[model samples]
Target: MNRMNWYVVYTKPKWEKKVAEKLNEIGIECYCPIITQIKQWSDRKKKVEIPLFNSYVFVKLPDMDRNSVFQVSGVVRYLFWLGKAAIVRNEEITAIKENLSNTNISDVCILPYKKGDKIKLETGVFSSQDAVVQEVTNTHYILVLESLGCLLKIKYKKDTL
Candidate 1:
């Protein structure tokens, strides 16, 4: 029997949920993490569920079934790492589930920076200041202001790093 593994599929813009649904309908297991948020407009506020990872969906399948997944509409390709299809470990998926389950959607956005990434403070009193990422948490990033010899932690909603 072919062993199953989790792999990330890159989808068309705004198609993460569609791809997952179609894959599931075809009997392929898939996971697309979504969070519910209140979206406000000038006229009204509405609750919307959005994919946590935009343009990406996870599919659990054996290597032999890769072509079947690719045949699905809206699936662009597999996410490749080092010339091979990137395989997501089971533990990583479990950790993601646990983290999201415990986190409030309004309190956190995705953390894209890793330790040692140089980023500029895009907004706030320290706007435009350059800092190094010292650590990352579920809801905040701990940054080190090298010149000032101080550490700062901030929560952000935009990809303004």
Candidate 2:
């Protein structure tokens, strides 16, 4: 029997929940972390649940069954890293769950920074890498990885780092 590994699936914008639901209905184990936020409109404010990671969802299955996920709607493809399917360790998933469940941590805010500021990556492939801020955009941070000597642009959502 093949062991299951957690792999990230890229989804169409705003489709993370639907895709995860479909996968679950099909007997596939999937996780899409959600957070509740209050959205303010011109008139009123309302609470909404949103995925933690935009366009991304995690699914666990054997490598050979990776293709099965494609049958679900809104699943674009599996995220790849270094020419192979990006595998997320079980511990990382557990950490995310634990962190999210912790009520003491109300919010995680990234301080406003300007160019040339030294910062350490908090997550993703370059987690813990020291990088210099190259440019700041409304949606992303163009960073120069000091140790790797490469440039990377990471997109950020308002509530996430």
Top lDDT hit: 2
* Candidate 2 residue-wise lDDT at 40: 100
* Alpha-carbon lDDT, every model: 0.72, 0.74
Report per-prediction Cα RMSD to one decimal.
Answer: 10.1, 7.6
List model 1 lDDT by residue over 2-95, tens digit each. 9999888889999999899999999999999787778999999999999877788889999988888977899999887667888877755664
lDDT of candidate 2 over 1-161, digit per residue (tens): 89999999999999999999999999999999787668899999998888877788999999999999999999999887677888877765765576556554444323333347788768854476566877766666566533222344445555654
Estimate TM-scores for all models: 0.69, 0.68
What local lDDT score does residue 12 receive in model 1, on the 0 to 100 scale?
98
Clash totals, every prediction: 0, 0
